[model samples]
Target chain A: MAPRSIFLLSSSRVHGYEFLEHAKEHLKEFLSKRKVKTVLFIPYAQSDYNKYTELVENTLKPWGYKVEGIHAKSNPIQAVLQAEALFVGGGNTFVLLKALYDANLIPIIRERVLQKGIPYIGSSAGTNVATLSIHTTNDMPVTFPPSFEALRLVPFNINPHYLDPDATTCHKGETRDERINEFIEYHKKQVLGLREGTALLVEGDIATLIGDRNAKLFLPNKEQAEFAPNSDMSFLLNKT
Target chain B: MAPRSIFLLSSSRVHGYEFLEHAKEHLKEFLSKRKVKTVLFIPYAQSDYNKYTELVENTLKPWGYKVEGIHAKSNPIQAVLQAEALFVGGGNTFVLLKALYDANLIPIIRERVLQKGIPYIGSSAGTNVATLSIHTTNDMPVTFPPSFEALRLVPFNINPHYLDPDATTCHKGETRDERINEFIEYHKKQVLGLREGTALLVEGDIATLIGDRNAKLFLPNKEQAEFAPNSDMSFLLNKT
Candidate 1:
């Protein structure tokens, strides 16, 4: 298998940051390393494709990268084939996966990232699809995709924008940790709880946690462990 | 169609309350008004059906209700048909709906509630299944049911344990309001956000909001509204 370059971002914007501003340096380094010129943006997660694409374009323009929306292209699959890199923006995971399935782009996108070694950038919902499935996503199922199956760029599932339980909260909804625990209770797969502002950058078989906050990992029948920023997470990529 | 008798509880346990403690009065009145003797318990949302049933049985025993686990019966369908009243306990909505689907009980249960006029009580996940679909649930997609389609006992969807945004948080994940807004964006259905310790009680054609807190209602193309406790919510039932 060819070495793959993937950036799974927890969120596009952290609190008090402009759109994609928190991820500026990392995005620049990843795209520069791949020598990417123009990036194809999957904005199907949002209702307004052009508007979403514009947001990404505006944010990345200063970084010396050109951005285009796949929705605008007459032939999306062909666009993927010719693209230097891919950027899937953050929004509802259900809507994003359903659009990907509707356009018949799942397999092609998977091939581009896994086989062709095109650098793939995913924020929130995008990060979700890059995983094995979107089973652990925090988004509501506003829409139904044909399947929860995703790109499988990574072996394990991811819970992006992972929030810890507020000690003072009185809300009775299951805590983020509890929800992940329930997910593992039935599906015997590891789930990485990617805290907000964190990103998992995988180059070939080596994966590294890329933020200040600790990333929590959950496996069935095992106590969850947390990884600090810059810790090597290559073991996750090696699983199955 | 006969008027459905239903209690859509936001949660089984509220903060500082024991299991079913916050809902004891509402549960007692609903079952008592219907003259229910033995309550059929569906504990599929949980891995341990027996343990879940016991918890409910213990909670309702003092209220003069005999709680029986549907899982214990030789014929689960027969159990629903013969149940004086039905109680669906809180847990994972995905697991609960899938088990109901696996047993082919969705139609039978709906018929029992809508046609037979038997009282149906739902807590959290249970409340989610009693509505048109489980799309608005706060629970993770821990497991995928065959479809997001759920029992159409009500015209709209209910988001049980609906939470308000934490103004102090730094997390960029979509808040509960944003999630419901996303659901309405695609589905065009009204979603009632049932806060913990709140419930919607329907008897015949009228539904009333119960508890001290107000319930939030999300409708497509309109500003979300909140209904104070004891408000007449029968308008929600007449939508379809």
Candidate 2:
């Protein structure tokens, strides 16, 4: 079996979705060679079926990919097992988790996508769950009331909406860097502070950053550094 | 047995020692009229045990209340069963949850404190845990990755460090009200948007807002209301 690919898109605010267009092209090319039809999963949109399905169908259909929204009430487990590709859209992380949990689709999705080698692409909450845990998500727990347990797709944490320090302003509140630093200090976990427009492309044990410039790497007890995109997806894959 | 009176503080910015002072007063008041002398529980100051223990003891000793800060090596279940009151201080919710999980203290604390009716007081992470869940905490999960499961001391969710909408702000980002509104839209859970110096006093399933004027009450599908600190506590308690 070809190694499954996982893409974690930063939140949509920073052109995260725009980069998805390029990603879709690559995905289409990969799937075409395999003679497989791409299948998109929108677990977060299950609550508002019509709206979410329309959004997913509208976005993926244009790329010549077949997309279907799986509502939890209707054989969600079967949907996961049969899908060739899963694309979880960004929304409220808590709401997404609740739907996943309610539908009992968490384990099924994990089994099929993570262990079964189905390609997975997630933005925002979708990306948030693609980590060992969803503790570092920028979205307030209020948006989706998290259970903290995620899909464990990656070993390290994902700091989506990774913002650089603003030097011109003296914002007394904790900066994004400070917050990630605090997480590193306590948890001692490696984190990928992905700026918007950045995506981590993972194929089996190889994980690489695509789009934008270098992303900030955060490791416990080590100084954070910005490294060029495409340096090594291996760091992410090896950790898992 | 007399119903144990518990005070759940909603403030997060207080220094450890400063908090210890207020805790000592409350403990003294509780113990002065009771036969209890010792209080066993976790502290928010995990890294610096000696310093935290000193601060805890300094205040408790003066009031003749024995205070023991459980160590990483200590069995939290054993400590909870023996303690008269459980004091959970404010800190990162994720860090606290990790410690609680590592120590296997959550079930024990819930059993002893909630089921057994041992007096409990929490602030910040402590306060967050006192609610039905910790899903609404404003603290970045990076600093304190949360599981969102809490002690359910109250039926409602809590947004500690709750700031009123500042009309003067020019920043395009969502305000605190807007964030809570987003949360209400998704979860439809009752949230007590607590300001600094505010406390939620719970007595026998009754929760009253104490301190600060006009704390905001966010209800699902209802208009937000400004509740005076001295307003009837039953209004909140009855919602459950």
Candidate 3:
């Protein structure tokens, strides 16, 4: 099996950046070394597949990259097998997972990405499905998937668009930090809270925290470690 | 069915109020006309049943109401069968639904409330499950339940702790309004956004929107209607 190559972005867009303008350079550098130029886009996370596919295609086409929508293809699994790179856009995590299950492409997508080492790019809900399960996503469960389990491509779960608690906010619902704490009470897997403008670059058993902010790490029975951006987070690769 | 006696409070607690304090007067009036003196409290939504039950017991015990924890009972179904009133506290909706399934109490609880007409009180997560399905809940799906389908006590789904878009806030993820809009894209139910301090008083075929503030209503195709606090929203009770 080839080494894992993946980019799990906290979100596709950040403050002061056009849709994916902020991650333009990072995305280019991540896939620059790869041989494939044509990318297969999975627009299943949203209800409007045509609009979602067009938005992603427009963003990457300018970079001399060709993007294709998987929904428009006749054979999805075969498309994944032949694709050079895979990009899963963000909308709703439950919607994305259900579409993946409905298409019966979970196994082959896992094979092409993990076994064949095709570069995988995910943002927000897209970034969420890269983990062991979809337990940590912040999106509403508008739909139910067959199981909470995901591709298991990564060792732990990822909480994308992880925002810090704003003490001034009057909303009484659980804050992001408290929600993750509650999740750990029921789940044992370590979770990395990726703040906006951050991405986890995974390559060959090594995962590095990239971007301008520090990421918070939550492990069972331990204090949350603040790992600064551009820090070596490959230790997370160690399956406890 | 004894005229559908149910009150779905948006939250158990409101700002500047003690736990369940804001809803105390409403609770007293809802169950006052009935003869049942003992109320059964299901603290399954939260982890600490002992503390949860005690807190609820203290609040209602002043009015000569006896509150007992269902978790402490030997046979939960029989306990529900004999209970005068049913109170479901708010915490996490997924946790509440999963525990309901685990205890094998869904059917019995359904019979007692729907068939026998026991006074049913629910707040937050509790209130979310009183609807047809839990698809509109704002709480995280920390645990999986037998199904998203609930008691079907109410014809439409309920979005508890439903806050309006904060014009001052800059958080970019989908707002509460956007989330419900997305839900309507896939689901065909009307979702009423119950702000804190608000509730849907479901009695027979009438659901009156009661509170100091106006609640936002979302239908499939029509513009969102703004209903006043005392507005008779019983029309929602009509199965669309």
How do the predictions measure up, each by TM-score?
Answer: 0.98, 0.73, 0.98
Q: List the residue pairs that clash in candidate 2.
A: A94-A144, A94-A145, A95-A144, A207-A233, A208-A233, B94-B144, B94-B145
Of the candidates shown, which would achieve the greatest lDDT relative to the real structure? Answer: 1
- Stretches of model 3 off by over 4 angstroms after superposition: none
Model 1 residue pairs with clashes: none
| Candidate 3 local lDDT, residue B123 | 93
- Kindly list the per-residue Cα lDDT of model 3 for residues B91-144, writing each as its tens digit: 888899888888888888888888888989999989988888888888767787
- The lDDT ranking, best first, is 1, 3, 2
Q: Residues A1-240, candidate 2, lDDT per residue (tens digit)?
A: 456678787754343244356456555654565455767567572346668767667776777777777764367777788888888877666677777777777788777766778888787778887787776766666643436678887788887767787675422234577777767776788888887767887877888787666788887775887878677857656653
State the C-alpha lDDT per candidate: 0.91, 0.68, 0.87
Among these predictions, the greatest DockQ belongs to 1
| Model 1 lDDT per residue over A1-240, tens place | 668999999999898889988878888999998899999999988888988999899988888999999999999999999999999988999999999999899999999889989999999999999999999999898888888999899999999999888778777778888889888888878899999889999999999999878999987774789899999999998775
- On TM-score, who's better, 1 or 2? 1
